[model samples]
Target: MATPVLSAERLAASYTYHAYRQLIDDLQAEGKTTGPQQSELLTNYTRLNVQRMHRLDKTVQLLPELREALAALRKPYVWLIITEGWCGDAAQIVPVLEAVAQASAGNITTHFLLRDDNLDLMDQYLTAGGRSIPKLVVLDAATLTEVANWGPRPATAQQMFLDLKSQDLPFEEFSTQLHGWYAKDKTQSTQRELLALLKSL
Candidate 1:
């Protein structure tokens, strides 16, 4: 039998239930189940909050490129998931990532980093204009050097910024985009680069 490729949907679902389970446990432990304080917050379903119990249930399916991403990452990898508990993007991407890690079996060790919790480490990347949560920083497990980084920022910009001082690089329009990042490319270039990086590895 051939091994199955871990789809993003499955990952999302796994993460959802896992997160929900924790929430439930916490609520029970704290006995704080009331109004919006607990109910609304509980309903917010984090990145790992909900999973389709039945396969037939209609849910957001994984995009093709994203599926390709899981395949790109080989075994024995280290993944740093730097994210905020409330960031929408983090909730959106975590499940897919979890699914990928799960499918890979013992090949990957995922380290979840809450941005607020790791201010010191985040400070390094902050200089590179990394102010957002859920940055999936992929690095070499052996050397501890960054293989590449992916998140809310452009791959080229992030890579360049990591490799050189901010002043050395021509802080061009990609520069201007940070102020209005919505106008920038849809991260397709970044994803493509990630794919290439994985293939090279």
Candidate 2:
């Protein structure tokens, strides 16, 4: 049998974007990261992600068209985002998503769930069979059923990742290049893609 769809109760239990940020902050205070695996490396990534999120939250600007679209949305939707604190892409992407939701004039709400904590859901939305995170499942607020989804990374960034993976570079070098891409792109790709998604809905 197929797995059951996500439920309203699960969304209720999930963290709001604000609470999720605070959870990461609290974990940082304890020298920890989200997920079952704990390590110095993962903790270090979480530290770096905190800086990334802080910067993005302050700097990401939505396009006027995207903002207009969000403001015009009439139906209520929930953006259920699956991510982890140590996820670099999530750090880069989640803030932009929050910005979009904030622009939606109460039409869009966002909830965050840790990928490891929601493996069943994560499995259903895997990127190439891997549980790549920052997976966004857009649900109809009234029915709690999926309407659309996007994530792991923007299309351009995902391609960059595939290329880097093929090259088999060290994690540090690989990460630096990937994040450099996000830094240069400045959330434009993310917003544009979501704008397209919104138009289709």
Cα lDDT, model 1, residue 159: 61
Quick one: best lDDT, which candidate? 2
lDDT (C-alpha) at residue 199 in model 1: 61
Q: Over all chains combined, what TM-score does candidate 1 have?
A: 0.50
- Give the per-residue lDDT digits (tens) of candidate 1, residues 1-201: 322222333333322435533554465455442123344444443322223111112333444665566656655766666664444444444544555556555556566655655566566565346566557766565544566666754556556435544456554443344423312433344445545545666
- Tens-digit lDDT track of model 2 for 140-195: 88888788899989999999999999999999999999999998998999999999
The superposed Cα distance between candidate 1 and the true structure at residue 154, in angstroms, equals 8.1
| Candidate 2 backbone collisions, by pair | none
Per-model TM-score on C-alpha atoms: 0.50, 0.97
Lowest summed lDDT across 10 adjacent residues in model 1 is found at 48-57
Q: Which regions in candidate 1 have their CA more than 4 angstroms from the true location?
A: 1-75, 127-130, 153-197
**How far out, in Å, is residue 156 in model 2?**
0.4
Compute the lDDT of residue 61 as modeled in candidate 1: 45
